[model samples]
Structures are given as C-alpha cells and as structure tokens.
Target: MNILSLGRSLASFIVVYGGIDLVAVHAFAPLRSLSADGLPRRRLTSRFSAGVDLKQNEDLQKYFQAAEERSLAQFARDDAPAWLQTIASLPFECTACGKCCKTIGSVYLSSEETWQAAELMNISSTEFIEAYASDIIRDSAEASNTWVRLKEKEVLKGTDHSPACIFLNSDTNQCQIYEARPTQCRTYPFWPNLLASPDAWDAEVRRMDHDSESTLLEWTPDAGGCEGMMILDQNSTTLGVPMKDVYRQLREYRQQDRYFPTGDKKADTER
Candidate 1:
C-alpha cells in the first residue's frame, strides 16, 4: 500500500479493533519526526493498530531506517549529554540471554501500547489491560500521573516463585511477544541509568545477572568476549544495523507530547 493508504489503514485498524477514537489519531499525526534528509518521517504512531505486520512491510522498514539515522545523528552533536556520549563511545550487543527479560522491574504500558499488544494477541484492548496490567501512580516532573504496568509472573523453582515479566517464557528464556513488546523492553541496555558511566553499566549487568540467576559476565572495554554480541563501530561491522540506533529510534516515539495524555490537563498537569 502507498504511504497515505498505509496511514489510513493503520488509523482505521486502531479505531475498529483497538477502539481508539479518530480524534486521538489526528492529534498524534503531527508528532512524526522529520528525517535527516528534510523529509517527514513515517512512523507508527498512536493511531497504529496491532494487525499490521511491520516485518513484511518494506516501506515501513525504510522509514524505520531513516528514523534510525536521525536518532544516531543526535548522539554526534557537540552538546549531547555526557550519558549519551558515553553510550555512543561504547559497543553493546544483546546476548539474548533473556536476563533483562527475567530480572528487570515492571514494564509500563501506555494506552497505545496496550491497544497494540492486545491486537497482536488477537484479544480486545480491555481484556489485555485487565489480564496483563495494573494501575500505578507515577510522579513526573509536573505531577503524579496514573499509568498501567505489565504484571509480573512468578518463576517457580520447586516451591519458590520469583518475579519475572509475564511475557518471558521460563523454559526457553525468551520473550513470548517480543515483536509487540513495549518500548521499555525494546530499549534495554541503552537506558539512561545504565549509560551514566562505565561503572553504572557494570552495576546494571551485575544486577541483571543476580536477579536472573545467570553467570556473572564481565564487560570488557574492548570487543573480545561475547560471541553473539557484535562490536559496534562506525565502520567494519556486518551485523546489520546496530541495536543502539534502533532502540534510539524507538525511544524517539515516546519523547513526544502526543504519546502522553496532554489533553487531560487534570490528570497530567504541566509544570
């Protein structure tokens, strides 16, 4: 389908299956970031429904590629924060050991995320929210806002049940709905806290290992130890696009006012 058709289809699917209002879709449309080439970015916004398979859509993939480049350029800025600079200089590769999936705290879900996940699961949005999420109050810079977080399941070993993400498969140590996972899950190692410094990253790795009962894996400043993990440099890497860039692009979607409930001034008071 053409870009306009794709956008319309996504918008219609959300309204029809996800039960989102059209007005909300229009409000979110303007948040699409401009590509580095000065073209508008084609992103899957809040209006996107769960049924569209992004993997099969080549145009969508190109859009994602453009968006990734835009995110990477941000890190090259002279005024980039220290944390971002630290991350840019380091090489990170997900071992796919599922340690983060098993150990990290709750995965918060936005309203858009809830709907998309529900559609991916072939269930109603209300059903998905009811089954997987719980309400929590989050204190933001402005005020406390109510949000939903994905519920955790207990990893049973004999008699004890340890906390783990509900979507994590204990037997395989992988995410069940990885493709539809929330943005929080998608941006794993690049989290601001972990990128604070080398020591902070080491601390986070240690915590993940401890929580998931995995062997202690040390982080080497050089790219030598891990087999599956790729050493990301500006050149000479054949591991496709680096995950750091992909995660940053995914993160950009959340850094917009449209992602949150800005219309509800009472619930989300501006500072």
Candidate 2:
C-alpha cells in the first residue's frame, strides 16, 4: 500500500502486520521497520499534492466508507435511522397464537361492558352472569366498584391454573365475542403489566412455550432462552380476515399511556 500517496500536510494511520500495530511515529521516521514476520516496513513522507489515494488501499477505503456511514446514522434527522425503525416494530406484533388469551391473568370488565356484551349475544344480563361471568369487587374502598370477571376453561395439561378464556373458540383458537368483547379483553397483551421489560414480549419471561412445555429446559439454567416468542409479525398470520381484524382491533386499543406499564401512578391501568 502507498501510504504517502495521500498528499496531505499531516496524516496518521496504523498499518496492521502480523497482528502488530505499526504506526508512523514522526515525519523523520515515517514507519518502524519490522522484519520478524518477513513483511517489509513502509516509510513515506507527509507532503501535500492535493491528491487522495484511499482507493488504492483497501483498508483505508473501508475505513473512510465506514466512518461516513456512522456519521450519517448518528447525525441524520427528521426521521429515525433504518435500524431504529426495525427495532421499534419489534416485540409488538401479536400473531394471534391465541396463547395470550389462553395463558392470562383474570380478565375483568366494567358493568357497562358486561351489559353491552350480554345484549350483543341476545341474552339478558342475568343469564350472561350465570353462564360466563361472575361478579367481583374492583375496589375495596367503595361497594359500588363491581366488575364482571370472565371464566377460563380448558386448562392446559399438567398445569391446574393455566386455562383458556371461556369465550375462546376451541376449534378456531379465536375469540368468539371479539367485536363485543369486554374492554379488558380489548386491551390484551398490551397491558401495562407486561410492558415492564421488552423481555416480557414472550408472554411471560424467556419461556415462550417451546411448542410443548417439556422442551422448555434441559438440565441447565436459561438453556432455552433463544426460543421464539409468542408475538409475531402481522403478516405471519394466514387466517385471513379474522386474524386481520384481531390485529386491527389491537392497534385501535392503544391508548395515550400505552408506553407505561402498571404500578406507575401516571399509567392508566385500564384502557
């Protein structure tokens, strides 16, 4: 490589040879000779001729190209960088694996929502409570804060507590009362509780249900950490309109406080 080809008043670069860093120490001694590895040393004077020979040296060419790329990525404005945009889309899409609907905490709805859901199903509120819901006190301070809690059935084998929501269709793995579903049902995995960490996108920690519970781990801590997550790209679904509607409903459910999870007083726990 012609190091002095770059006509400049002052220039500095490191030439890597045999894993050793050889630098031009001074104008008098442009480079230190090292013949231990059978590589001839370079010595060139720093004199300006208004010409740059970065193209001749592949390493220098790559260095300047990478430097230019980094500057653009760091300084460009008005829009996010390409990599940032890709990351923003991450841990967000719900493939409707229906896992969240199945493996979930208690699903509750306001009294108004209960009535609306009941009416949509062409049933009286009294019958709805008896068949699908139970009354629960939302707040202990006042007796007026009562909400309807949806029941869960079809417990996952080997786990007593893991049950699918009662409204979930066993045949299609889709919500039966999707349009008329409760507000709580409307705001699903989007719950502030799950937003505490990006890691929670797996629908509850690193264990994203490796197909079957048996393959979760194998004689080691954090062994299956790389397993795929529950959420997926919106385009990953092939269920057509039904699946598309579910994603559309979720996007509409996003509230102003969607970024914050529960426990922060400013966060609106109920969407």
Candidate 3:
C-alpha cells in the first residue's frame, strides 16, 4: 500500500484500539482528550443522540463501530446486561400495544407536552400539574422542564391485575389522549434503548407482552422472568417499512426532543 494509505490506517487504529491520549488527532488536532471511559473529554450535551454533529467527525464514527463490535463480542459470552450493543436487527413496529403504557415509571412528559395534554383534556396546565404531574425536580434550572407523571390506575384482567396509564381503556386497550400524547410515548419502540441490539429488542418487546410485572432473567435460562411472549421470527422490520425510514424516524424524534424542548413557542414567530 502507499505511504498515505498506511498512515491513515495507523491513525484509525490508534483512535479505536489504542489507549491513552491522542483521540482524533489526525486532521483536527486534539479535538478531544482521552477520558476514563475512552470517550471524548468535553461537556457533551449527549453521546449518541446528536446524530448530525457526531456524523460530521469521521474518527468518532469509526470509534463507535469498533466499540460496538467489542460489546457484541462480550455479549456473546456474558449474555447479561445487554449494554453498548448496537444494531436493532429490524425496525420496530408499534401495534398500539398498551404493554409499555402499563409499566410504572415508563413515561415522563416534558413541560410543554404536559400543558398541551391539559388543554386537550379541557383542564388548565396549573390544575393538570396539581392533579396529574409529579414534582421530581424543583428549585433548579431543569425544574419543571421534565418530570410530569401521568395517571397510574390499577386494572384487573380475568385473574390478574396490572398497572396502566389512566388514559388506557381496559376494555379496548386504546389510549384516550392519543393526539395529545407526549414525545416519549410518540417515539415508542424506536427509542435508543430499544434499538441498541436484537437481544434488547426481544427482551423489551416480549416482556411487555406479558401480564405480570416483567423481570429479566436473573439466575439461569429458566428463571423468574417473562416467558409468555414467544421469540418472534423478525424476518423483516415490521413488514413493509424500510430500514432507512426507521432510522429517519429516530433522527426526527431526536431532533424534535433537542430543538423544541418546552412547546411550540416559536410556532407563531415562525409563521
């Protein structure tokens, strides 16, 4: 190979596998110093969600690819706590499954989304905050920026009972306030956690399919955990949806969460 090609390869190797300082020092020249976790040393707003900015740096992309590969290898042996594994074999297709909504502490609405839901319900945001939302954070900049709690009602099904969103009708299993649902609810099944890897995908999806409080396998293969939902043969992402479209959906979701935090305050100004 040519000297130029060899140098480029060496730089890529140093960034990915090589440890210590000298992260992405090829063209940019010390854009980031090596941190304890081998990630870039900076006051990062986010690690993976900022797709646009992250993609601009070629070295970061290669570093992510290498890290993901290593994690997948570790997962093969450990098969526990499936973290850092990327690639959700197929795109997620939400069947309006209320399983996710039933889980406690699964949904939290942003400040702006909270008021929008209130207006739809004909209740003022003040009243809604008093009744529906919970004060998780107070006396801080992020105070009320997030941490709106929805109604958690207990519902009986035949022989068992499960916690569900107050808006979820037990008989029909449909969201009452679908139009006014928060961004977290709207971007179900495609959230970064769900898209980490196929194992995570199956574990999350199937666990939701169960009626009981789903628990991950703790001891052995046959242990206290969800077993009702069968391991699906996810041949294609949903049926007709393309992979690109799914990625695009996730990108849009991230962008919306990043740009429009409170509400459409700029809606009138833009118009």
lDDT score at residue 117, model 1, on the 0-100 scale: 77
Q: TM-scores of all models?
A: 0.54, 0.42, 0.48
Q: List the residue pairs that clash in candidate 1.
A: none
Model 2 residue 60 CA deviation in Å: 58
Model 1: per-residue Cα lDDT over 177-260, one tens digit each: 775666556655545544445555455443233345555464332211232333344542334434345334334433432345
1-271 in candidate 3: lDDT tens per residue?
A: 4557545644543544333334232111112222333343332324223322334555555655566345434433354223322323353455555566665443556565676678789999889888775443232444445545565775556845556677788888798778677656665555555555666556654444344564533212122122322333544434433443334334334544453435423222210
Query: Which candidate gets the maximum lDDT versus the true structure?
Result: 1
How far out, in Å, is residue 198 in model 2?
2.9
Question: What is the lDDT, from 0 to 100, of the residue 51 in candidate 2?
Answer: 32
Q: What is candidate 2's lDDT per residue for 173-201, written digit by digit as tens? A: 79887766654555454443443344444
Q: What local distance difference test score does each model get?
A: 0.51, 0.44, 0.48
The local distance difference test score of model 3 is 0.48
Q: What is the C-alpha RMSD of each candidate to the true structure, in Å?
A: 9.6, 23.7, 14.3
- List residue ranges in candidate 3 displaced over 4 A: 1-91, 136-139, 142-146, 154-159, 207-234, 237-240, 252-271
